[model samples]
Target: MSRIGKRPVDLPSGVSATVSGQMVEVKGPKGTRSFTATDDVTLAMEDNAITVTPRGKSKKALQQWGMSRTMVANLVQGVTEGFKKELEITGVGYRAQMQGNTLKLALGYSHDVDFQVPSGVTVTCPKQTEIVIEGSDQQLVGQVAANIREWRAPEPYKGKGIKYKGEFIFRKEGKKK
Candidate 1:
């Protein structure tokens, strides 16, 4: 038995969880988020909460049980409190700007990199160096941050590039003369 799967997810007031087709939708005061669970996992709405159960006792089913439950738990928390990720540009010429729902990143590249912000996600830049990604879906917020960081990952030589705030990069030593 999975310890995580055995735990029941309690639904707070004004929050509702439902299974629609293969997807599980979690609605809360903050927002709504959904995810398509694995085929072997079964989702059931009980009282004011939801339950995840495996179809069989096999290893595969057991493996998915905890994962599916954890994903559902994250969705519930996301819809309730939302999620955010911060990014920082660490270079002399690198910067970021928000034009409406689009993010313009100039990371020492010849051309500017433009990324369209998805619906239900908000990107805010207090300063050109600081960026914050917010969304009700934890997964979506994380994916967006990763995609943005991929545009110009931190370079080892100068340790200059786009990276998440508080991200650590080991600096490489230059060759001896």
Candidate 2:
């Protein structure tokens, strides 16, 4: 039995859920999101809660049970509270600023990097060294942050680059004299 799957996801006061076949749709204040589960698992909505159960006693069924449950939970959270990811820029003259729908980044490059902001997600730069990404979809928010960080990943030697908030870079020794 799957521990997480056994626990039903509770619907908060302003949130509602509907189950049709193998698909589950959740609507909340933030937005509406849906998930389609595999045939190995079943989805049901009852008493303002959603539950997932495996169709049979098999390894794949059990695996899908837990994953399906988590996916449903994420849908609920996404519609209700949404998701957010923060990035920090480190290095001299490296900064970030929002210009309309574009995120202008200065990561020590000769030319500024312009990142186009996608729909359904909002990117903000509270400070020159800070970037905050917010959106109803968790996956999109994370992907956007990753794409930005890819431009200038933090290096171990000087640690000069863009990185997630609270992330630590393992320092390496420099060349010996």
Candidate 3:
């Protein structure tokens, strides 16, 4: 038995969820999100809560049970509170700024990197060294932050580059003179 799958996802006030066949849709003040579970799991809505149960005792069904439950939970949270990711740029000449819907980054490269913001996501640069990504979809927010950080990942020596705000970079000693 899956502990997480057994627990029903409670809908907060002002949030509503509906399940039709293998698809579940959640609506809240922020936005609406939908998730489609595999046939191995069944989705049911009752008493302001949604539950996921395996269709059979097969391995695939059991695997989808817990995953479907978590996916439903994420849908609720996404429509209610949304998701956010923060990135910090560290270097002598590295910086980030928002130009309209585009994010301009200077990571000591020959040419500045221009990142076009995708729909349903908002990119903001509060400070030259800070980048904030916000969206109703958690996966999109994380992916956008990762794409920006990929340009200049924090290096082991001196730790100069872009990284998550609270990320830690292991330092390496320099060669002896």
Candidate 4:
């Protein structure tokens, strides 16, 4: 009954997958990633593809059925092409720079904020006001970008702060003089 769970995940060229017990591991050009599914669902592999099916007619089994399939698909995409997130600094005196594995941010504060880059993710500042985060894991890439943006989130007035590229800031009117 789950539409998403019915579709099998296809393996592209140069990508490989192995399912052992309840764990599924995918290897590709970007990297190798794995996921362990719960007993509510069953996983099968054939012809460079993977499929998921519910173990019983219960609600939990159906829920896990679709989630497990999507997780497998994400693992395939993550290992093959990876993920990226871009952040833009839009305030005066707000900027960022990468020093080796560390990122230094200036957000109009008295002191600069130094962010240490963690393993499995790469953060780069192409320009003074631009920050780019890339990694094989989608969740890690998004979390790192969010952490950087949280340091100086965009405000309503004048929209001065850091924000995701193309993100809209709901502007509010200033008080009357």
Candidate 5:
């Protein structure tokens, strides 16, 4: 048995978790989110918490049991406090601006890159080069941030590009003749 799988995900007041078929729905004061359990993983809600159990002792069951447990936990957290991701634009001419629900980024490119903010997520530019993305769903927030950063990932030489705040970009030394 997986230690993490055996543990219960405590639900705070006003939070409710429901398991239906392979889908787990977590509703709270903030919002509601749902996730589907993987194969061979059984989810049960009790004591205002969630317990994940595997059907058998097979390797696949064990692997999915832990994964499904964590996924449910994340969904619960998402409804409660949510998640956030911050990105920093580093370059001479790099910057970002929020136009309504769209984000415009200038990453030293000839043309600017425009990205639309998905529902349930908010993008804010505190500074010209700082971008903050916030949402309840961690996976969606992360994926959206990644898509924005992918436009111009930080380069190794000058470390000038789009990167996550506090992210370390190892610089490669030039050839010393």
Candidate 6:
């Protein structure tokens, strides 16, 4: 039995969840998101909470049970509070700015990097060194942030690059003289 799968996901006020077969859809103030779980796990909606259970006593079924429950919970949270990621540029000349729907980045590169923001996800540069990513889909928001960070990852020595706001970079000792 899965501990996490045993707990039910409560639907807050102004949020509604519908379960049809293996698919569960959640609609909230932010947006509506749906997920289709594997056949090993079953989905049920009771009152204002959603629950998940495995079909049989198998390893795969048990594994999916917890995962399915988490996914459903994420859906509910996504539609309500949504997801956000913040990135901070750390370098002398590194900064970020927005031009219409494109994100212009200056990361000490030869040319300014231009990142096109996707439809569902919104990218904002509140400050020259800060980048804010927000969206209802958790996966999309994270992927967009990762793509932007890939342009210039923080280095261990100088720690100069684009990285998450709370991320830490371990420094290495310089070569002996």
Best by lDDT: 2
What would the per-residue lDDT of candidate 6 be over residues 39-149, giving only the tens digit for each residue? Answer: 999899887899999999999999999999999999989989999999999999899999999999998889999999999899999999999999999999999999999
Backbone clash pairs for candidate 4 read none
Compared with the true structure, all predictions reach lDDT values of 0.88, 0.95, 0.92, 0.93, 0.90, 0.94
Could you estimate the TM-score for every candidate?
Answer: 0.89, 0.98, 0.98, 0.97, 0.94, 0.98
Task: In candidate 1, list every pair of residues with a backbone clash.
Answer: none
Residue clash pairs of candidate 3:
none
lDDT of 1: 0.88
If both were scored by lDDT, which would come out higher, candidate 5 or candidate 6?
6
Model 3: worst 10 consecutive residues (lDDT sum): 74-83
The lDDT-based order of candidates, best leading, equals 2, 6, 4, 3, 5, 1
- The true-versus-predicted C-alpha distance at residue 137 of model 3, in Å, is 0.7
Instruction: Please list the residue runs of candidate 4 whose C-alpha ends up more than 4 Å from where it truly belongs after superposition.
Output: none
Clashes of each: 0, 0, 0, 0, 0, 0
lDDT tens readout by residue for model 1, 1-177: 999997778888888877886698888887777889888888888877788899999999999999999988898888788899999889998889999989999887789999999988999999999899998878789999999999989998888988888888988998999
lDDT of 3 by residue, 1-177 (tens): 999999999999999888899999899998999999999998998889998999999999998999999989988998888899999999998998989999999889899999999999999999999999998898899999899989999999999999998999999998998
Candidate 5: where is the Cα deviation over 4 Å?
A: 175-177
Better of 5 and 6 by TM-score: 6
Pairwise TM-score winner, candidates 1 and 2: 2
| Model 1 vs truth, CA RMSD | 1.9
lDDT for 116 in candidate 4 is 97
